[model samples]
Target: MLIYNMWPMWVIVVAVFLYLSIKSYKERNAKDVIILMTVVIIFSFLTVRSVNWLYGWNIF
Candidate 1:
Protein backbone atom coordinates (compact mmCIF):
# COMPACT_ATOMS: atom_id res chain seq x y z
CA MET A 1 0.00 0.00 0.00
CA LEU A 2 1.16 3.49 -0.80
CA ILE A 3 1.39 5.47 2.42
CA TYR A 4 1.32 8.82 0.68
CA ASN A 5 -2.24 8.13 -0.43
CA MET A 6 -3.37 7.60 3.13
CA TRP A 7 -1.26 9.63 5.53
CA PRO A 8 -2.20 13.17 4.66
CA MET A 9 -5.74 12.97 5.94
CA TRP A 10 -4.64 11.25 9.10
CA VAL A 11 -2.07 13.99 9.64
CA ILE A 12 -4.73 16.61 9.34
CA VAL A 13 -6.91 14.79 11.83
CA VAL A 14 -4.07 14.60 14.34
CA ALA A 15 -3.18 18.26 13.80
CA VAL A 16 -6.71 19.35 14.55
CA PHE A 17 -6.82 17.19 17.65
CA LEU A 18 -3.57 18.69 18.90
CA TYR A 19 -4.85 22.20 18.33
CA LEU A 20 -8.06 21.52 20.21
CA SER A 21 -6.23 19.78 23.02
CA ILE A 22 -3.92 22.76 23.47
CA LYS A 23 -6.81 25.18 23.50
CA SER A 24 -8.66 23.15 26.07
CA TYR A 25 -5.57 22.94 28.22
CA LYS A 26 -5.03 26.68 28.16
CA GLU A 27 -8.64 27.20 29.29
CA ARG A 28 -7.95 25.04 32.38
CA ASN A 29 -11.00 22.91 31.85
CA ALA A 30 -9.99 19.45 32.95
CA LYS A 31 -13.26 17.83 31.96
CA ASP A 32 -13.29 19.15 28.42
CA VAL A 33 -9.66 18.29 27.93
CA ILE A 34 -10.19 14.71 29.05
CA ILE A 35 -13.27 14.24 26.94
CA LEU A 36 -11.69 15.88 23.92
CA MET A 37 -8.59 13.76 24.22
CA THR A 38 -10.68 10.60 24.47
CA VAL A 39 -12.75 11.60 21.47
CA VAL A 40 -9.63 12.38 19.47
CA ILE A 41 -8.14 8.99 20.13
CA ILE A 42 -11.31 7.10 19.35
CA PHE A 43 -12.05 9.10 16.25
CA SER A 44 -8.50 8.78 14.95
CA PHE A 45 -8.52 5.03 15.47
CA LEU A 46 -11.87 4.55 13.82
CA THR A 47 -11.02 6.78 10.88
CA VAL A 48 -7.65 5.19 10.23
CA ARG A 49 -9.15 1.74 10.47
CA SER A 50 -11.86 2.71 8.07
CA VAL A 51 -9.31 3.92 5.55
CA ASN A 52 -7.30 0.78 5.96
CA TRP A 53 -10.37 -1.36 5.37
CA LEU A 54 -11.16 0.55 2.23
CA TYR A 55 -7.65 -0.19 0.95
CA GLY A 56 -8.00 -3.87 1.93
CA TRP A 57 -5.32 -3.53 4.56
CA ASN A 58 -5.52 -5.83 7.56
CA ILE A 59 -4.97 -3.56 10.54
CA PHE A 60 -5.44 -6.36 13.04
Candidate 2:
Protein backbone atom coordinates (compact mmCIF):
# COMPACT_ATOMS: atom_id res chain seq x y z
CA MET A 1 0.00 0.00 0.00
CA LEU A 2 1.14 3.47 -0.85
CA ILE A 3 0.36 6.54 1.25
CA TYR A 4 -0.33 9.81 -0.42
CA ASN A 5 0.52 13.05 1.34
CA MET A 6 -1.13 16.47 1.11
CA TRP A 7 0.96 17.62 -1.80
CA PRO A 8 -1.95 19.39 -3.47
CA MET A 9 -2.41 21.71 -0.52
CA TRP A 10 1.20 22.74 -0.67
CA VAL A 11 0.96 23.37 -4.39
CA ILE A 12 -2.10 25.54 -3.94
CA VAL A 13 -0.52 27.52 -1.15
CA VAL A 14 2.65 28.15 -3.16
CA ALA A 15 0.73 29.09 -6.28
CA VAL A 16 -1.48 31.53 -4.48
CA PHE A 17 1.48 33.06 -2.72
CA LEU A 18 3.33 33.55 -5.96
CA TYR A 19 0.30 34.99 -7.71
CA LEU A 20 -0.38 37.45 -4.94
CA SER A 21 3.26 38.45 -4.70
CA ILE A 22 3.45 39.13 -8.40
CA LYS A 23 0.16 40.99 -8.42
CA SER A 24 1.28 43.17 -5.56
CA TYR A 25 4.56 43.89 -7.25
CA LYS A 26 2.87 44.79 -10.54
CA GLU A 27 0.47 47.11 -8.74
CA ARG A 28 3.28 48.69 -6.77
CA ASN A 29 1.74 47.72 -3.46
CA ALA A 30 4.83 47.49 -1.33
CA LYS A 31 3.01 47.15 1.96
CA ASP A 32 0.70 44.45 0.65
CA VAL A 33 3.62 42.64 -0.90
CA ILE A 34 5.47 42.64 2.38
CA ILE A 35 2.45 41.33 4.24
CA LEU A 36 1.80 38.63 1.67
CA MET A 37 5.44 37.57 1.67
CA THR A 38 5.39 37.36 5.46
CA VAL A 39 2.32 35.16 5.36
CA VAL A 40 3.90 32.94 2.71
CA ILE A 41 7.01 32.52 4.82
CA ILE A 42 4.99 31.59 7.88
CA PHE A 43 2.95 29.05 5.95
CA SER A 44 6.08 27.57 4.40
CA PHE A 45 7.61 27.13 7.83
CA LEU A 46 4.49 25.48 9.18
CA THR A 47 4.32 23.15 6.17
CA VAL A 48 7.89 22.04 6.76
CA ARG A 49 7.28 21.49 10.43
CA SER A 50 4.15 19.49 9.76
CA VAL A 51 5.89 17.34 7.19
CA ASN A 52 8.75 16.72 9.58
CA TRP A 53 6.32 15.69 12.29
CA LEU A 54 4.47 13.39 9.96
CA TYR A 55 7.76 11.72 8.98
CA GLY A 56 8.69 11.27 12.64
CA TRP A 57 11.45 13.85 12.51
CA ASN A 58 12.11 16.12 15.44
CA ILE A 59 12.08 19.66 14.15
CA PHE A 60 11.59 21.33 17.46
Q: What C-alpha lDDT values do all the predictions have? A: 0.75, 0.76
User: What is the TM-score (0 to 1) of candidate 1?
Assistant: 0.61
Candidate 2 has a TM-score of 0.69
Residue 15 alpha-carbon offset, candidate 2, angstroms: 2.4
Q: Per-residue CA lDDT of candidate 1, range 1-60, in tens?
A: 454357567767777886898799999988888977887787678667767766778875
Q: What residue pairs clash in candidate 2, if any at all?
A: none
lDDT accuracy of residue 7 in candidate 1: 57
Candidate 2 off by > 4 Å: 1-11, 57-60
- For residues 1-52, what per-residue lDDT tens digits would candidate 2 score against the true structure? 0112664486578679978998999999999999888878877776776677
> How many pairs of residues collide in model 1?
0
Error of 1 at 8 (Å): 9.5
